[model samples]
Target: MERIVCLLIFIIFNVVAQDEFIFWAELSNKNFILHHQNETISMAMTKSKNKTLEYACEITYVQNDFKEKMYDDFGVIAEEKMTKLDKFNFLNIHKNDLIDCFFNSKIDVKDFVKSEQTYVQSETYVRILPLRFVVEFHDNSAFIYYLK
Candidate 1:
């Protein structure tokens, strides 16, 4: 019974550590899209009135995609998609610092990216719950990671 209890504790600790690692690893990636509950968060940066850059953690969704033919003579089309789904913004002054801190950690960023790609390529959706996130990828032929 004592051995069993120790095993359970180890499992719990490892699970918690993995969750924390995923959270930080995703944030460190430049093209990270995270969904928690019913909202999605993506990093965006803009210049403030003083011209100093300000960063935003906001929610956004893709509404539609518009494709226009660049030239009638050729088969090239320029595509553009835009959507805004910000219910609220959390302005963190040290967001970059937080991301940088992860880079300095022992977590392997390349492994994280590779693992994410494998999930994205899977036919079925992947869920990392308790955080309650659904990693739904589109276009299986090309690994595109998007969350819903």
Candidate 2:
């Protein structure tokens, strides 16, 4: 009986700790590309409840040679022409309560690029709560940011 109660408590804790919404996207995939010229990626989210929540967010760019490795390993082909990434930026919709989360997300690859000569690609996993969200990369690196 004691063990059963402990197990039930553990299950409830795990469920409460998990994010309400989780999204995954391969940034290099054409489906996620919003503007080829701008090198933008976008993902859509939906929720049944209509509630507005204010939050903050943090964007981090890690420099690495993962781009070349990603293309080689995943067979992702790069175009002959590439956009020069000058600055990294992130955008999401929070003003509209109808939108549960990010409507048209955009992420630039400038700060994330290791060098000018290397290509850039990323796989992102996003976990969203009512007041906060976390973006995690394939490398196990993550950033905790709040959204408004």
Candidate 3:
């Protein structure tokens, strides 16, 4: 009985592993983010409720509650973008420059809120906005975003 159970388990595990490997291994090839203009797009790939990988892309310039919202917003949107990410890809935007935008999307917020009730959750302070910056969050997760 033990041997039979072990054999079944091994077979099931192998199948599951193969599926997961295929899913992840093909990500680089099939991911929409890979083909997008890296300079203007920022993507966050995360696992979904269905145990599938999902991604959210941000243009990075719009809705960034920065110091000067009006001027920046005008310059970015007039250029006709889904979101304002003009400044995020600036070559002059050094690592020291302070800029912020939510790297994760609204769907992520909704999912978080569903999990922990007390307060609404959001993907705030994702340090990957400025694109030129690399951040090591308190959770020891290091994120380096490339825009260009």
Candidate 4:
């Protein structure tokens, strides 16, 4: 009885300590594409500044391009196919998780926290969420939640 109660408490504490945040961005032109070899995961796109776009890119898989089209002067057009991309490599930042990541990675988020701005990172891409304070990311991007 007491052991069961203790177990339940432990589970609840861990669950509350972890929070999840969702992130999203617009996929603009070719500049937004992030590719490795033949695989690609593009950005968000929208026609209206108000609504979401039709085609949002996510790295569902990665594959090697092997089929070759031999040209007299030029190189082959190698065949590309679907393969798996590691979820850990994908950069998906959630609003709440920003502070936690910074702390875990030994980064500073004091300024953003004080300013009430939501911070996100993607190596070359860093943003602050303003409109909704919360957003969603690809299912694979869901990460740890933080408190304080």
Best by lDDT: 2
lDDT of 2 by residue, 58-114 (tens): 333345423453333345423221111211121222122212334344323322223
- Candidate 3 — what's its lDDT? 0.28
**After superposition, which runs of candidate 3 have C-alpha atoms over 4 Å from their true positions?**
21-49, 55-148
Alpha-carbon local distance difference test for all models:
0.27, 0.32, 0.28, 0.28
In candidate 4, what are the lDDT values of residues 12-105, reduced to their tens digit?
6544422222232322222334422111222222112343322222322223312232112344221122111212133332222333333222
Candidate 2 residue pairs in backbone clash: 55-147, 55-148, 56-146
TM-score of each predicted structure versus truth: 0.17, 0.24, 0.18, 0.16
- How far residue 58's Cα lies from its native spot in candidate 2, in Å, is 2.3
Instruction: Write down the RMSD of candidate 2 (Cα, Å).
Output: 19.9
User: By TM-score, how accurate is candidate 4?
Assistant: 0.16
Model 1 scores a C-alpha lDDT of: 0.27
Better of 1 and 4 by lDDT: 4
Instruction: Give the number of colliding residue pairs in candidate 3.
Output: 3
- Residue range 1-148, candidate 3, lDDT tens digits: 9999999876665444321111001111111233211223332222113342332222233233333432333343222221223333421242222222323322111111223566443322111323222221111122333222
